[model samples]
Target: MEAQVINIMTYEVIGSKDKAVAVIAYGVKTPKKLAKNIMKTHKNIKSVLQKTGERTGVYRIHPCKLLAGNKNTEVIHKENGFSIKVDPQKVYFSVREAEERQHIANMVKSGEKILIMFSGANPFGIAIKKKHSDVYITSVEINPAAVAYANKNNKLNKINRVRNICADIRHAKLEKFDRIIMPLPETAISFLDAAYHFAKKGANIHVYTFNRSFNEAARDVADTCHMFNIKCHKVGEHKVLPYGPGIYKFRIDLKV
Candidate 1:
């Protein structure tokens, strides 16, 4: 007999394969029933979860309700030839940002000292190590849970040369780096001065932000640079994702 299927349009699969497939059925009126139906129809999916809250707090983790199959929330997410173990309920992990992480990694030159701010689960640092093995990276995150998972992921991926630090970037006594990455688009600009302070002369800083238009994104970067008295030139601007109806998450690469 064929198992029942839920409407694909009403839900999204957040992660998959060799583990439980996490699905968010926020738009579905009968989420639990839909989740159970998904688990019954999809053989590869061992579990189904409904997202319970918006991602919030310093860790950016969202609460989830298990509707079917196993109770485990921890799972291995394989991407870019690496295995990353993360518990969505404990720490933030976005499959959507995987490509953006790799893009940043591709921009790095060999032997550069790099700092990744808000390096959640070390995906950014690990992607860089996988692409460019010679570079030294310091991955800083405020959430202890994220830091632990990041270290675990680094070991799982056999990635070396990345130093994971669990502390607020503003309070961490960090050495100047050749390239600084600010990945938190919502508030990356607020930390621009800290990035400038920790960057060596002629360093490249990649700052991500959210704005309604490309012009506004560029202006935000330029205004932040002016506030820091740093000479900033836009190397490139990329629209990472559509944040809302008219707003977008953008990355503005700047040279100082």
Candidate 2:
């Protein structure tokens, strides 16, 4: 029997693993019906979830509604040959940013001590450690759930070099690192001073920001570096993802 063809224009799969698929429906009148249609079309998709709201708060969590199949929210997300157990409703895990994570990992030097601010689920740190086993990483996050999962993921991934800390980055007493990563795009600029204070001389800092253009992002980075008295040379600029219609999430890599 031939399978029915459902229009895919209304929804797109944001994430998927094993038997589950998470989707964001747009211009669809009956999302539940669409979910059922999605399950009918895709045999591997046993669970279908609809993302309801924007990712918000320090934890960067989004609300999800189960439209079909299993009710479990937790799933094992695999990327770059590593496994991460994430509950999308509880913590921030952007499957979209997997490539960006790898890009950052590729830039790490041997024996470098790295600090990851807002290390939700520890993907960035894990990715870095997986790429460079000689490097040590310190992951700081405010959310307890994210921290717990970070620890779990670290064990699951068998990454011993990453130290997952459950504390706000502003108050955490941290040692200097050879590299600092700020993944929180919307407010990463606000934490530049802290990142600068914790960075070793001749270190690299990768800051993600949402802005209208790369020039705007560079200007912001340059201004922040000037304020901190850190002589920053822009190593690279990359458009990580589209934040909205006009704004984009950009990564500005700097050598201090």
User: How good is model 2 by TM-score?
Assistant: 0.90
Error of 1 at 22 (Å): 1.3
Name the weakest run of 10 consecutive residues (lDDT summed) in model 2: 1-10
Best candidate, TM-score-wise? 1
Candidate 1 lDDT over residue span 85-131, tens digit each: 88777788777777898889889999999999999888888888998
How displaced is residue 79 in candidate 2, in Å?
1.0
**For candidate 2, lDDT tens digit of each residue in 68-166?**
887776777777788777777688876667789889999988999999999988989888888899898999999999999999998989878789999
Every candidate's lDDT: 0.82, 0.81
Those runs of model 1 whose alpha carbons end farther than 4 Å from true positions after fitting are 1-16
Q: Estimate each model's TM-score.
A: 0.92, 0.90
Candidate 1 lDDT: 0.82
RMSD of candidate 2 to true structure, Å: 3.9
